[model samples]
Target chain A: MRNIIIPAVLFILVITFVALNLFYITDNASRLDAILVSASDAAKNGDFEEATAEVERFKEEFSAVGKYLFAVIQHNEVDDVIFSSNRLLALCNADTKEQFLSEIEVTRESIKLIRDAEIPYLENIL
Target chain B: MAVAVIRTVILYIIIVFAVRVTGKRQIGQLSPTELVITLMLSELAVLPMEDMQKPLLAGVIPIFVLVIVEFFVSAVVLKSIRLRRILNGRPMPIIENGRINQQNMKKIKLSLDELAEELRILGSYDIETVSEAVMETNGQMSIVLKEDYEPLCKDNMKAKKEERKVPAVVISDGEIQKEGLLKAGIDKEQLKSILQKNGCSSAKEVFYMTSKAKNSYFIVKKEKKQ
Candidate 1:
């Protein structure tokens, strides 16, 4: 009984840890999505100052989770999203509304890629 | 940098767990399939440990999956002799009836020089004296000496044999084993009287005590260390 129970409990603890990691990845990505949307909205209305402030806020939040994200998620995708977000900030500084909106879309796509990569796919199913 | 550290630590812990799942056999003792799995698992774990970019799950998921597959395969092989033979391969008799089995030697891909070297390692320097040499599943060579070359054992000697019993540890470091006393068919009072006769004040004074037979006993006194 002890032998069976010990392994079962360890198995449950391991599953719980993996589930917690998934929950953290999704929650972090969702929170970043919200920030990106707010920044994009400010960018669209030509509110450059407001957009820059939101972008700074986004960078701060991203930095907080950046280390953990790199550890848990695919690095290249996370890197792409981060680079695009940085490019969006640069476009805001240059006051190029057209390029800023384009970079914002790229950043959004990159973020989605990171999230989707973590989701269990057909390749992972096997 | 901290993320890389965390990744390394996690991968180390997980790999340890996976290896533990695969029993405690030494690397050389593992079957061909087990060796392959172990090598692959080590390779899989390295990618995530060194490259923080790779998701921890990227390394962890596959490792756990491999462990599960290996475990399933092992369990299946246990229930089926044919599967076990196919998977782990059977021990091959390289020498039978004082003759080298060339066919089995070729099947095992062992050359004459290697076979002789293995035989020498088993203390059979000359293959001519070996009646049978088998290559065990764990890759160990087991050699059986020819009747003429075999050592004379006790059965070959006409010597008087006496009944012998395993020595029961009655007292260890001041604690008396009641069970050992019971097995020897002696009670606590008898033990105290025996200790009195032996010049030991009590069982506490003795460091080690063993009952060799129904009556024979040995006691080692506890030495004081300054």
Candidate 2:
């Protein structure tokens, strides 16, 4: 009885943990992408101040969620997003509209890749 | 440095726990699935230990997932004979009725030389002596000798032998073992008399003592320091 129970409990725990991770990465990725899009639109409209604020907010949120992400996602994938985020922030601070907009797109894609990797899609599984 | 030390300790504990969960099969006795699990466990544990940037949970989660899967598979296999056969192939009989089953041996890829080697290892120099020889799923050979080749015992000679109780150590390094005395079926007074008979004043004077029965005992006195 104990033999069955321990493994069953652990199996449930692993499943729950994986499901929670999928929810977390998906929710957080969309949130981060929304922020990047807002920042990109602001920079395109010549609103450097709002764009800078949005970029700053993006960095703060990413850093907060990154601690959790590091445990679930591969360190390299999470680090790639972190690196791109920093680059986007640097471009935002410099008020480089053209570069900042493009960097925002790149950062958003990286975040999407992380979330996609977590999803149990046929393409991703293969 | 401290991070490495802490991670090593944590991973070590997790690995030990994982192995314990898999049960007490030795390396040589592990089935194919068990061997794969054991290999994967060590590989998974070493990844985080080598690269600090790799999250510890990355290593831990997979280890646990594998353990849980293996556990469930074992449970399912227990109740399903077909699944058991699929996972662990049926034991192949290499020899039957003092004759080598060449077709079965060939099917399992057991060469004649290998069979001879295994038989030699099992104390049978000649294959003809083995009435039955099976290659178990764990890869060990089980051999049964023919009636004429079987070793002679007391039963074969029709001799009667006395049943003797296992010797229980009642004293070790001058200390009394209460459980051992109970097993030997002797009380403190009987132990004292046994010690007196053996010319020992007390248990402290004896180095080792064992009792096979209530009155039967073996005692060795401690040597005086030079």
Best by DockQ: 1
Please list the residue runs of candidate 1 whose C-alpha ends up more than 4 Å from where it truly belongs after superposition: A1-126, B158-226
Docking class of 1: incorrect
Runs of candidate 2 exceeding 4 Å displacement = A1-126, B161-178, B187-210, B217-226
Q: Give one digit per residue, the lDDT tens place, for model 2 in A34-62.
A: 99899898999999999989988998999
Encode model 1's per-residue lDDT on B1-226: one tens digit a residue: 3344456667888888999988778997998778988999999999877764467788889999999999999999989999999988899999999999999989989999999999888888899999999999889889899989998876667667787788888999888998889877889999999998998989989899899887889999888767
User: The CA-based lDDT of model 1 is what?
Assistant: 0.83
| TM-score of each predicted structure versus truth | 0.52, 0.56
Which consecutive 10 residues in model 2 chain B have the weakest lDDT in total? B1-10
Question: Which candidate number maximizes TM-score?
Answer: 2
Error of 1 at A106 (Å): 14
State residue B148's C-alpha deviation in candidate 2, in Å: 0.7
Model 1 chain A weakest 10-residue run by lDDT: A117-126
Positional deviation of B182 in candidate 1, in angstroms?
12
| Model 1 per-residue lDDT tens digits across residues A15-80 | 677667767777888888888888889988889999999888888888788888887766777688
